[model samples]
Target chain A: MFSKILVANRGEIAVRIMRACRELGVATVAVYSEADRGALHVQVADEAVFIGPAPALESYLNMERLVEAAHHTGAEAIHPGYGFLAENPEFVRLCEEAGLVFIGPDSKAMALVGDKIRARQVVEEVGVPIIPGMKKSFPNLEDYRQAAQEIGYPVMIKASAGGGGKGMRIVYQEEDLLPALEAGQREAKAAFGDEAVYLEKYLEEPRHVEFQVLADHEGNIVHLFERECSIQRRHQKIVEETPSLALDDDLRFRMGEAAKKVMQAVGYTNAGTVEFLLDKDKNFYFLEVNARLQVEHPVTELTTGIDLVHQQIRIAAGQRLSFSQEEINQRGHALECRIYAEDPAKNFLPSSGRIIYLREPVGPGIRHDGGVYAGFEVPIYYDPILAKLITWGETRDQACARMKKALEDYVILGIKTTIPFLREVVQHPAFLEGKISTHFIPRYFSEWRPRPPSPEGQRLALIGAALREMKQGRERKRPTQLMSAGQDFLSPWQTLGPWRLGRRS
Target chain B: MNFEFMVDQKRIPVAIEKTSQGWEIDLGEAKVVVDAHWISENCVSLILEGKSYTLHVVPVDNGYLCYVQGELWSLGRPTQDLEYSQADQAGAVGDKLKVKAPMPGKVIKINVQEGEAVRENQTLAVVEAMKMENEIKAAQAGRVKKILVSVGELVDADRPLIELEEE
Candidate 1:
């Protein structure tokens, strides 16, 4: 095993990778931008290196700086924890050139799968089902229109190198196709520096499910069950759960086999995820392959008792697979709610401020992978995700109930968050019954408002607030000017009962 | 002590008087006892009708922002008549529109120059925050009078980005 590994990312996932390395008795190095001098990931690592300025283009996404940081720290391997350069095939090649092992699949497999169009072709060649769409990117408007017509209307224009909903659009008619194609190309060039995009047949009311696949360097591969991630807003997943209600035992087995076959076909190694879109009739089609550890990997980890990061490290060190597919069983159910620093009421606009108060939930079957402390200032230059609240139980209902209770116990103040909105989602009857699609947020909660407090609760809050001011004012006053009994309405001697003041307040 | 409490934009006038037993709060016909004890700097324990409630309070400019039972209330001693002003709530009025940022972020691009005519929904500036670029658009057709911020400047939420003169 490598004595030291460098984490080339920031936020919760960086900290997560370092934690796994530390447990394996390996020292870890953290690379940070100027804006992340006091970031949690830097504080947790054994060594830290300043990469560049605040912008991701100059820091996290700069492959030269990342390799230099690893070389400077003498890190034997580099773990690009999701986002940034995690799935960049060029970054993997650079790591290889610098004599450092990239803790993911080789660059050959990544190049084959990173391009969405090429991925569709490869999966289809291996007898895996893919959505009926263009085999390659369109060159011009006429070509795109022809492909859209062949695939029928209501097709999707997606960037070949895009994720997280950027550089993508859904066109419902020919009139919308030109504007969407132009917009898609512009966004793709801005986001990925590539103007290549392809068409995909849009499936209405399809549930987003994905299978986790882990492969070792010695041609051994296994597949974990599936996670239902249909709860989304603006094409980004907000909530995820394992052992989807839409998949029965038979369907789950088939998806698992299909995932393993795809990975095996690509000579894939380390941990990766194969996403699928499950339609209303229980038929599933391959969506794309995420060639790195996912943000929602914890949901799969908790269910199968598999430490994916540790496995990734082992595979990079040329280790054989420790467990077979039959041994990996999905036990119990796990749900994950991504707690972001955004206001759901304001079109999910991201908000940034210092965290004044934070109370993480704690109990059996509960885990909170948080990245910020009470006094940490959430920066405006990165993702808005602050933490992930995960819960587990013997049954899906039990897990849902635990997740709802855990959300109530979680508290974060001084900035807007999606906690209240997430609580509403988990408690909704449709969600509990597993009748959800990617349009869950828009169809059911487009104009949802927070549940108002009871009238009695409001009255009590005002009274308490008024008294709080009075108490603070009196404490700041001079001792000699302290009010006597019956002098003012805010006199402590009059407001405090004798019996209650004796005990702890 | 007399104060006005703002809850969801509705202001309620409350009056309190010291009594032999506890503080009596008068809100029109309803009277309640509020026995408050200071627990810490930002926390207070209050008892009303034998039920205890713990409240978190943060002192703001001229008022107290308190949280109780997952509800937020702002209590302030009305400086004067406490009339609600829509000007503070909305950014602009009449023909002119004040383009403001939806959230705190750094300005990355200024698309329009001062004195340039812009149509409704035309991109005026791009502010990048939370790793996403949001374009600030013109709400109404007008000529830009002043650009309040430059590129790479950090701005707070609702801070004016550009001021438009009625065209």
Candidate 2:
């Protein structure tokens, strides 16, 4: 086992990986940008180093800076959490050249699967089902339109280098293809710095299901069942659950095997997710592959009682698979809701501000992987996800019930969040019946607005307001001038000078 | 004490009195008792009508930004004449108003000058933040009265950009 590892990411995933490393009796080194010097991940890690400025290009995304940080801290290995440099094959190769163990698949498998078009070909060669579409990138909008016509109407134009739904568009008519293609290419170039795009037949109302696959360097591979992630907005998943209501045991077994086949075909190691789109008839097609630990891995952990990060480290250390396929079973149902710092009504645009207050939900079956705390400034330099709220129960209904309650218990102020929107989604009757598809949000919540507070809620607000007045009035009468509300706006690092770091108990 | 507050921009009259168990509040249509305990300077644990709730209250310039049941409400003492906030008055962006940067970023470009005519949804300026360039659009058919910002200048969130007079 490695004595120390450097986490090449920030936010909740970085903290999450550090926690796993601590549990395994390993030291963790965290790299942070100037904006993140006092971030939760920095505070949580065993050691910390300054990487660069706030912009990711000069900081988290800078492979050289990360390698230098690892070398300086004497970290034997580097773990790239989900975002930032996680899936960048160049970063992996750089780490390897530096003689550091990259806790993910080797660059060879990454290059082969990281590109959406190449993965489709690889999966197709292995007899795994894939979406019927172009295997090559379309050079122009006219070529894209012709491909869409051949594939029939209602086709999806997607960026070849895209993930997270940034460079994806669905067009129902040939006339709209040109604009949609242009938009997709533009977004792809801006978000991923790649303008290449491909066309595919758009399946109406398909459920997005993916399988979690883990492999060791010795070629041993296993699939951790499936997670249904049909609840999304703007092509990004917000809600996910395990043991999809749409899949039966037979289908689950088949998909699990197929997921493993794709991994084996690429000689892949470490942890990855093989995504598929399931249609109404139970037929599934390969979507793409996520080449790192996913944001929703906690759902799988809750259902199977396995810590995926631990397994990833073990595999990266060249260890054999400790458990076989027969050992993994879905003992219960789990659900996860991503808490984002955005307003659902205004097209989910990212919102940035200090978190004036934060109360994470806690109890039996509730797990919150949060990145920020009260007084933490959610910067505009990165992803808007603040935390992921997950709940597990013996049955699906129990899990849903707990999820609704947990959402209610969760409180965050000073910025708009998607909690209310997610709560409505889980409580919707269609969601309870497991009849959701990728188009669920647009189909059901096209005109969704944050419902106004009820009369009871108004009464509560009034009481809260009155209490605020009383408190302020009392504070005004006191001789001390401490505890100003403005204090919440200042970063602790700014107020406390540099932070003093020591090993946390 | 009796007070009037603007809830979601609508004025509501509320009456409050301290009771042994909690506080009694009377809205026009009904009355309810709320038990509230201050958890912090801005957070309160409340039980209203026998249901538990927690509220986060932040003080704004003329109001308290209260969060209740996943909704944010700006609560403030009603103005003597019930003057509308800039948003309420600027709704539909008619004769005169200033276009503000919704969120802070660098001003990449300004498409209109101080006396240019513009149509609704026309790109007035572009601000880049979080690596995405957002085009600030005109809300109504108007002529630009003043350009408050210049290209390449960094602006804070919600800072006014261009003033417009409806054409």
Candidate 3:
């Protein structure tokens, strides 16, 4: 194990990896941008270093600064958690050159899989089922239109170097292809610094299922079963679960085996996910490879009782597979809902502000992996995800019921979130029955919204507001507990950590 | 004490009194005597009409936001009417149309100048927030009266980016 590890990321994933490093008695060094001063991740780490300005391109995305920060902190390993530098093969190469262990696959493997078009060609050679599409990116819109003509209508446009739905669009007509392709290329360039993109046949109503795998340097790889991630909005998954209600035992085993084959073909290492889209007739096609620890790994952790972060760090440290495949048993069903700092009522626009209140759900089956505090500012320069809520139970019904209740119990103020939207999802009859697909949000919730607050609800809210005002008025007359709600400074309570957020005891 | 608050921009009245049994609150349509207890800082537990509920209140800009269950409503005092605070709220405010950035972000593109005609739903500008670009559109056919912000400048959640005089 490394004596020290530098987390080249920010927000919840950075905090999450730091927690794992703490558990392993490894010191964690956090690198932050100007926007992330006093962020929860900064406070939670053993040491902190300033990277650059708020723009991620100058800060988190700068490979040189991240490597320098790791060197300054004497970190032997760098854990690129999920977003910024996780899948960037160049960053991996830089870390290797700096003699710092990059806690993921080698640059060669990352480059091979990072290019989705190339991965498809290679996955096909291994005889794994894949969606039929263009073999390479086209030079112009006219070329793209011709390719789409061959693929038929309702084709999908995807960034060649994309994940997390940034550079992805579905066009059902030739008229929409040009604009959609241009937009995809632009987003891909902004997100991945790559303008290349390819086309694919849009699979209708396919359930998005992905398998988790762990491979070691000693060449041992094992599949950790599947996670059903069909619930999505804007092509990004919002809800996910393990032991998909869509798959039976026989089908699960085959998909799991196929997922291992896909990773094995690419020489994938550490922790990565193989996504597959299962059609209405139960036939599955390769979606893409998520070449990092995913945002929804907690769902798999609760069911399989394996700490994936621990495995990532250990694997990068040249540790062999600590356990065999037969020993890994998924005991129960698990579900995860991504909590984002966005308002669902207003097209899910990002809500950036200081969080004035936060109350995480807690119980025997609920888990919250959070990044924001009561007074922390959610910066506008990065992904809007604030946390993820996961729940586990003996049965799917038990898990679903717990998830709904936990959502109701979860409270966050000062910014809009998707708690209400996710609550509506788990309560839907189709969701409870597991009849979901990648188009679930559009098909079911195109115009779905929370019912207007009843008269009783309105009254209570107004009265509550009045009471708060009255309290404020009294405080103005006689200040107590340092009563000043007008400032955005860090209160003593925020510096006093482990109190506001419901950290796992 | 009588308090008038704007709930989602619609003003409503709330009156509270100290009664023999805890506090009595009047909400125009109904009157009830209730038990209110402080469960935590800014969090209240109330028992009214034989029903129990928990409400969380936090101070926001020129107002407070109260949350219960899945509902969150903002309460702003009518004393200082800063219309800019309503920037991210759906729909144009007070009939004077303004194209505002939905969230705080760096402005990437401005499609029109101070004196330019635009169609309803025209993409007036694009602001990148949280790494995703959001296009600000005109509510109706209008002429841009003022370009309040420039491209590549950072903006807040409700700051007006462009002022429009509608047809």
Q: What is the lDDT of residue A176 in candidate 2?
A: 77
lDDT string, candidate 2, B12-82, tens digits: 88877788877777878777787888776677787776777778888766878787876667787788325
**Model 3, range A1-505, lDDT digits (tens) per residue?**
8999999999889989988998887888999999999688888887899999988889999999989999898999999999777889899999989999999999999998998889999999999899989988878778999999999989988988868888888999988888788778877877877888899999888999999999999889998999999999989999999999889989999998889898899999999999999999999999889999999999999999999999999999999998998889988899999999998889999999878888888898999888887777888989999999999999999999999999999888878899999999999999998888888899999998767887666788888888887777777787456634322234343365433245443
TM-score of chain A of each: 0.91, 0.93, 0.95
CAPRI-style docking class of model 1 based on DockQ = acceptable
Which scores higher on DockQ, 1 or 2?
2
Tens-digit lDDT track of model 2 for A1-505: 9999999988889888988998888889989998897688888787899999987778988889889999999999999997677777778899889999999999888877777888899999999999999888866667777788788988887877647776787889877788677667766765565788898888988999999999998878999999999998878899999989999999999999999999888868999999999998999999888889999999999998889999999999989988999999998899999999887777666778887767778899999888887778888777788999999999999999999999987878777789988999999999988889999999999899888668756766766777787678778899996665645433342354223358355
Interface RMSD of candidate 3, in Å, is 2.5
Docking class of 3: medium
Q: Residues A331-391, candidate 1, lDDT per residue (tens digit)?
A: 9999999999998777778889876655577898998887776567888878898989999
Best-fitting candidate, scored by lDDT: 3
lDDT of each: 0.83, 0.84, 0.87
Clashing pairs in 1: none
Cand. 1 TM to true fold: 0.87
Residue A331 in candidate 3 has what lDDT?
Answer: 84
Listed models, DockQ each: 0.43, 0.46, 0.57
Error of 3 at A69 (Å): 0.8
How does the DockQ of candidate 2 come out? 0.46
Query: Candidate 2 vs candidate 3: which has greater DockQ?
Result: 3
Task: Give the residue spans of candidate 1 off by over 4 A.
Answer: A138-142, A189-195, A470-505, B1-54, B60-64, B74-96, B106-126, B141-155, B165-167
